[model samples]
Target: MIDAGALTRCRHRVHLDAAFPEQLAAAPEDPGVRQRQDAATAKREGIRRTLTEHAPDRWVQIDREQSARRRAEDTLAACAAGADRIWGAVLPLDRDVGRKAHCEILIRDTDRGGYIPVIVVNHKVTDPGRGAVTSGMFEWEPREDLARKPRGQARDQMRVAQVYRMLEQHGFASPALVAGAIGYGSDVIFVHDLTAILEDYDERFVDRLAIARGESATVPSKIGECRSCPWWPGCEEQLTQTHDVSLVASGSRADLLREAGCRTIDDLAAWDQEPIEDWPHGAFEDAVVTAKAWLAGAPLVRRYSQIRVTRADIEVDVDMESYQEHGAYLWGTLLNADGISVYRPFVSWDPLPTPDEARSFAEFWTWLMAEREAAALSGKTFAAYCYSRAAEDKWLLDSARRFVGTPGIPTEDEIREFIDSPQWVDIYQAVSDQFICPAGKGLKKIAPVAGFRWRDADASGEASMSWYREAVGYDGEPDLSQRERLLQYNEDDVIATKVLREWMSDRAESEIPLATDL
Candidate 1:
C-alpha cells in the first residue's frame, strides 16, 4: 500500500498544480491539459486559491473542483500504478458504476477496516461567516433564516426554513472531516509538507498526522442591494414599513443632510421627516420647527453622525501583518491605502492584498477600529474578517491568559472562552493581518517576501510563539524587554509592509494598472 507520507506529498503537489497553474506553471497533468485547467490561473483563480481556509460542505456537492482533482489523480495514479490502495481522507463511498467519490485510501489499524479520511476543499464552497448569516443570493429568505441560522441547524428541517435547505445542501462545519482531507489535499499542500508523510503506517502515525481545521468564516455583506443577499426582501420590507428613509436621499444620511445643511435628525423629523433636508437655507428645519415639530410625531432623534469617514488631509495607509498565535514570527504582509492603491485584494496584487493593507507602524489601527460602527455597511474590513473564526487550537492559551484591560469579562480565561465568539474579532489575526502582513494570501511565505528578514531571529516566521511554548510549562514573569523588542519588531513589520505596498503601487501604476484594479 502507498505510505501516507507519499500520498500527502502527491496530493498536495496536485492541489498546487491544479489550483495555481500560473504560479507553478506546473500543469494539472504533465502538459497535455494545459488548454483550460492549466491556463494562467487568473487573478480570480489566484484569489480563490488564497481562500484555502474556506471549503465545500461535502464530498459530492462540489463537482467542478472534483473533476479537476480527478484529472490530476488520473496522471498521478498512472505513475503510482506500482503502489497498492491509494490512502485518502474520505472513504470510498458507494458510487454509481462510473461515478467517482474520493480516491480510496487504506488505514492500517481502524476498527472499520481502517476508515479513510475525506477532505472537501472546493473553491465553490461558500460559508455564512460566523456572524450567523447566510449568503445573499435569494430574495424571500427571512433575516433569521439568512443571517442568524446555521445551515446545519436548519438542513434536516429544510421545509421548516430556507436556510435549512442550504445546510441540507452544504452540510455542517466540521474540523475532523475537514482536517482529514486538507491534511493531504489543497489547504496547505503547496505551503507545507503535505507531501512529507511517512512511507509506512503505524499507531504512531496518528500522532504524526498534523492536521488543523476551523470555522474560517467570512462576514456577510451586500455586493449590491439585497438582490443577492438572502435577507434582502425581508430587510427591505422591514426598512420600508417603519421609516420612509427614501426621502433622506441616500443609503447613509449625512450626505443628503449636508446638502440641505440641516445637520441633525431632530430638524429632519420636525419637517414631518420629509425631504425638507433638501430645503434651501436650512429652510427644511424651518418647516418642521413651524409645525410644533416637537409633538408632530416626527421620529426619535438620531444621536450620532450618519456618515463616519472623517476627511483627513494627511496621507494615510493601511497595513496588515499575519502571524500564527504563540509563534514568534511574521507570516505575511497585506498593504492598502486610499487614492493610490486599488481596494480589491486578488484583483490588485498578483498574490493580492495581504500585506498591502498593513501600513506604517499600524497608525491606521485607531481610525480603522474607530470607524467600525459606521463602516459596517462598507466593504470587508480587517475586523469583520479576523474575528469570525472557530477556535480549533490551544495556540492562544497565553493571550487568553493575559489580562486585557477591557470591560467585557472578568478574567483572562473568560475572554479565552469567548475568543471564538462570533461578535469578537481575533486580535492576533487582526493586528497581524492589518499592521504586519504584506500578502496574507500565504501566511508562511509573505513575511520573508516583504523583507522583514526574520528567519534567523524567530526561526519559524511567527511571533511570540516561543514565549507561548515556554509559558505553557511555567508562570515566569513575561520578558517585557523582549516584548518591547517584539513590539518594535512588529512595528517595524508594519513599516516594512507600508514600504512594500508603496513599491507595489508604483510598480502597478507603471507596468500593471489592470492588475492593480484589484
Candidate 2:
C-alpha cells in the first residue's frame, strides 16, 4: 500500500510504476533527491521530538529504524494497546482490499478519547495577514482555534482525505484531520473535516489505485509535477510516441482538450474543424497553431499591430542576481542611448545584508533615476527592459523598502509609480503574448532562438547562484573567480534581454498574426 504522502504528491502513473518492487530494486539513487528526503526526515523527527518533550507522559515514540512492514505492524500494535499519543505511527490498509492507504501519525483526542490522524509537513504556515494561513499555493481561512476549516479550501486536501480514510478503516473514530506544520519557534496545527469529501471520492480512489497497481494502462497527465519526477524521462518518451497534446500545452488547456476527446497534438490541431460546443473563444485555434508549429520544428512567433513599445533613444536592460539563501547582491544594467552602450554594475560581496548591500542598492536606484531625469531633460523617453520582470521588479522594490530612510533610496511612491508605468518593459510578457514556445518560455530557452548567446558556455541563473554561494566562502577563503563568473553571467543576462528586445522590434514589421489573434 502506498503512503498518504505518495497518494497526495505523485500525479503520474509513471511515478507509481517507479515505486513498484522491480523498479525500486533497479533504479539508482540520486544524491540530490536523497539529500532532500533526508532533510525532510530530519525535520519530521525534530517536530516529533519537540511534541514528545511538551507532553512526555502522553506521547509514545515509535522507532523508525525498523523495516516498513514491521513498522506498520508496530503502529497497529500500539494503537490496539490504546496508546495516548502514537508518534511516527505507520498504519497501512489491507492490500487485499483493492485500495491501499498508509497514514503517518495517529494521535488520541484527550476529550473525545478517539484517535485523530495527523499529517506532518516540513513547511512554514505563515500568516501573511488576517486569520489566513499560507497553505501550499493558496491562503486558507481557519477557525479561531485552528481546529477545523472547509475541506475544499486548500490545494493539498488529498493528503487529509487519504489519511482520514486510512484511519476510518483502522476503526479510529475522528471528526477531522489534523495537519502539523513546523513554524519558526513552535508548531502550528490546522484541522479540517473530510468525511463527506472522502465518501464522494471513495469509488474514484479505488479506480485510480487499480491503475496504480498495474491493473490498467496509466495515461500521462502532464503537469508541473513532471519537473522533479525521476520517471519523467521514460514518460516523456511515451508521450512523444503518442503525440500527446500535453507535450506542447500544459495545465487546464491540456486537460480541457483531453476531456473533449482531443488526445494528441494532431487531434488538437484538427479540433477547430469540428469545434466542441461552448468552446472558449480562440483557445482551440491558438492550440492548433501552436501544435502545428511544434510539429514543423519551427519557432512560433507572432506579431501584433498594437505594439507595446517602440524603439526608444534611451533604454536600460536590467538584470538582478540574488542567492535564495541570501538577499539580492548584484544589479547589472546595460545602458544604450543613441548608439552608445555602457555596462554598469552595483554589487555587494557580503553573504548577509550589511551596510555595504544597502549602499549598493541605494546607489543603483540613484543612478537609474538620474538617467531617467537626464532622458526627460533631453526630450527622450527612458525605459527599463527586463526578461521575467517579476523577480527583478520584486527585488528592486523589496530592497528599497528594506533600505528605507537610507541615503539615495527612492520613496515608496516613486518606486510604485515606476513599476506601474509602461516605462518598465517586461520583454517576457511581450514575447509570450505574441509567441508560443514549445521548448520553453524561459529567458535562456527563448533568447538563443533570437540568436543571442552568452560568452561563457556555462552561464545560467542556477550556475550563477552556485558561484555566488562559493564566492561568499562559507568554509574556506573567498574565490574571486567565482565572484567574477557571477558578474559576467549577470552581464550576459542583461545583454540577452537587450538583444531579445531588438529582435522582437525587428520582427514587428512582419505581417504575422498575434497568438491572441489566432
Candidate 3:
C-alpha cells in the first residue's frame, strides 16, 4: 500500500524505483542519517505536543484506528465536536483494502461544516501559502523570518492533492488548507483553497502512479538527492561499470547527448574523432572534453588552454563558522608567505549579539584591513581566499549593516568594494570553471583528493554546530575541549582552502593537468 509519504517521493523516478526494494532490504546503519531522522522525529513530537497543549480540552486523539472503516468512523466522530482540534486522526482512502492516512492535526470548522487537515513539518517551509491554493490542503512548517516571502512551485501542489483525495474518499468535508509553521518562538498559520490543484492532480498523478508501478527498469539520475540514498552505492557501481554519461553530465546536457546517440562516456569520448549526426553544434567540443576528462579521471578540464593567475605575494585563506540562530561566531584565517604559515582565529564565546561578540567582529575587521593596508604599503599584492564566497560575503555585509555605529566596523561601501575587488577570490568557482568534479564538488570531498586531511576524522559543519552548542553550555557546563575542537576544525577549513589555492597555482604554472583533467 502506497502512503502519502511514499507517493510524495515518487516525483523522482530513481527514488521510486529504489523505495520498495530498500523497504524490504536490511540496510546498513548510517550515524549521520540516523541523527537527522531522530532530530526530525523529536521536532515533530515537540510541535505536536505544543499544538495539543494549545487546544488541550478540544483535541481528540484517534491514532489507534485498526482499519479504514474504523478510521473513517473515528474521524467522523471526532469531527462532530465542531471548532475543536483532532490530533493524529486517521482518514481512510479505501475501506476494503484498509488504506489510510494518519493526519497530524485536523480542525473541524463549525460554520463551514468540514475538516481542515494540517500536515506537520519540522523543517523550514520552502513554500507556505501556494501549496494549499494549488492542491487544496494545508502545510505546517517552521518560519525563521516571518518577513520573508513564501515561495513554491506548482508541482508541490500534488502532495496536498493526495491528502485531499483521502479526505474525499473517506466522506469527510473538505475545506481550506491551514499551514502551521512553528519557529522563532511562534507558530505561523497560512490558509488556501486547493480545488484546482486537486483536480489537476487527479488528471496527472493518477496515471503516473500506474506507470510507476509497472516500471521494472531503474532510471538512474545523478543529482543531489542521491547523496543520502541507501541505493547510491549499488547504483553508482552499476553506472560506473556501464560508463554512464550521467557520471560526467546531467539535466538537459545528458538528455541532449543521449538523444544524439552518445549514451555513455565511452561514446562521447570517441565522438570528437567521428562526430555524431545531428549532435548539438555548440556543445559538441565541450561534451567531448568533459567525456575525456571523466574517462581519464582528470581533476579538471580547462575550456581555454591559457590559465589566468592573479599574482599575489601575501595570501590569506578565510573560513567562517556560524549558527543560523546566532550570527558569525568564528572567523578563521590562514596567512601564507614565503616559507611562513600562521593561523589566526577571531571568535565570540556568546551565542548571540553581546559586547563580546561585537568586540570579536570589530577585531576581525580591523586585523583584516590592517593586513591589507600593510601589503599595499610594502608594494606586495594581498588576496583573501574562501571556498564559497556567499556565506562569508553575506556575514561581512550583514555585520557591517547591523553594527554600523560600532567602532572598527567598515562602511558598507568599503566592504562591497573589497568583496568585488580582485583581492577576494572564491576557490570553488575557480576550481569548477577549470575542472569537471566526478566525485563531488564540496570542499571536504575535493580537498582530500589534493592530499589535505583534517586532524578530526568526523569534522563537518553539523558536527561543529553540535560542538559549539556544547561549548556555549547548551546542555551543561561549557566544555573547553569542545571549544578547542571547534577552533581546530575551523582552522583545518581555512588551511584546506589554502591547499586548494596552492595546488591550482602549481597546476596553472606547470600547465600539467592532473589525471582527471581534460
Off by over 4 Å in 1: 1-464, 471-477, 480-482, 507-518
Give the worst 10-residue stretch by lDDT in candidate 3.
133-142
Cα lDDT over the full model 1: 0.29
Order the candidates by lDDT, highest first: 2, 3, 1
Local distance difference test, each candidate: 0.29, 0.68, 0.67
Q: What is the C-alpha RMSD of each candidate to the true structure, in Å?
A: 21.9, 5.5, 5.5
Off by over 4 Å in 2: 8-108, 115-142, 145-155, 167-174, 182-187, 196-204, 271-282, 305-310, 321-330, 337-363, 377-380, 397-411, 454-488, 507-518
lDDT of 2: 0.68
TM-scores, all models, native as reference: 0.24, 0.75, 0.77
Indicate the TM-score of model 3.
0.77
Residue 459's lDDT within candidate 1 is 32
Model 3 gets an lDDT of: 0.67
Residues 328-374 of candidate 1 have per-residue lDDT tens digits of 12222233334442221111111111333222112232343344433
lDDT of 2 at 451: 84
- Give Cα distance to truth, residue 112, candidate 2, Å: 1.8
- Candidate with maximal TM-score: 3
Minimum summed lDDT over a 10-residue window in model 2 is located at 133-142
Indicate the worst ten consecutive residues by lDDT in candidate 1.
Answer: 344-353
